[model samples]
Target: MMQRFIPLGNGYSDIYELMYIGRAMPERVRHMLVLHPFDENNPEASLALVMKPTNPGNFQPIYICLEGVPIPSKRYDLWRELADELQHDVIELTVSPSGKFSDQEIFFQHLIGILRTNHYLPRLQRSF
Candidate 1:
């Protein structure tokens, strides 16, 4: 199975698009996540949704809006509300900021490891 992060753009207005996916395809939503890559003093956050793997392709896509919105903002509230309506609890975690990595790919790789280790995402199966 292959796992990937598909960025939806910075939270700003793009958050609506993320919400729409959750509402339109509620069954595909596996998890809702809020990643805080900085200290508590920082108010910005990243939102993400992990979707169930595709049937034919076995591709698990994690949609994200990397650290772009403030925690108490309307967008963040809307995300939480969507999760509630979908009966999914938002999972929050503190992680190293994406800026620490050389590129977005590396940053997502780091997050994948964390999600797997924490049992939020499935471990990769080895093929003999």
Candidate 2:
């Protein structure tokens, strides 16, 4: 399966897109994952929506707002409100800070691996 992250703005306006997508495609929405990773350098969080893949399709589109909004901070009120409104519990995971990674791509790769290992995503198959 293929996973794609669609970036959104880091403000209220951008957050609305997340809300809109969830509300508009409630059926397509499968799960929500919230990551709270922090270090001495920066404290932040990410919200990811795991939507159901299309029938017979290998693509699994994941809409995300990376550090879109300050998290674990009072600013996180918006995120809390979203979960409350959607009535979906956010699967919170504490991970290594993004700063620890050499780049954003690596950090995201680590997060995806975590999800896969935890069974959030399907594991790879091996054929002899």
Candidate 3:
């Protein structure tokens, strides 16, 4: 399946938007992801929404906040609250910072690699 990450800015307000997407489309929410990536020397956390692929298409989307928040636990708490409300648990992963790469495209590629390696993402020759 094809995957895409929809960046929704930083934390706080954007997090609310992320939660809203879950509430709005409960069926589409395949799962949630909490990505912890260090920014420079400061470690931070972020949230993402993994959406179910559309019918007749393999386009699955993962909405996230590329820039992380100062408090990892706080972001995780927000995700917890969302999980409590949704009655679904989110998958959490610690990854290398986007800053490691030269640009966003490469950063996303790195993330895609991490996910696939962890079996979170379908393999290259995956059967659909």
Best by lDDT: 1
Q: Say what the RMSD of model 1 is.
A: 1.3
Better of 1 and 3 by TM-score: 1
User: For each candidate, what TM-score against the reference?
Assistant: 0.95, 0.79, 0.85
Preferred candidate (TM-score higher): 2 or 3: 3
- Pairs of colliding residues, candidate 1: none
Candidate 3's C-alpha runs over 4 A off are 38-40, 72-75, 125-128
lDDT of 1 by residue, 1-128 (tens): 89999999989989999888889889999999999886655568999999999999899999998899797888888998998999999999999888778988999999999999999999998778
In model 2, the clashing pairs are none
- Of 1 and 3, the candidate ahead on lDDT is 1
Q: Candidate 3, overall lDDT? A: 0.78
lDDT of each: 0.91, 0.72, 0.78
Clashes in predicted model 3: 0
Descending-lDDT candidate ranking: 1, 3, 2
Ranking by TM-score: 1, 3, 2
Those runs of model 2 whose alpha carbons end farther than 4 Å from true positions after fitting are 72-75, 125-128
TM-score of 3: 0.85
**Tens digits of per-residue lDDT for model 3 on 1-128?**
77878889877678888888999998888777788784558477667887887787888788887656665456668778888888788787888887788988888878878877887777766675
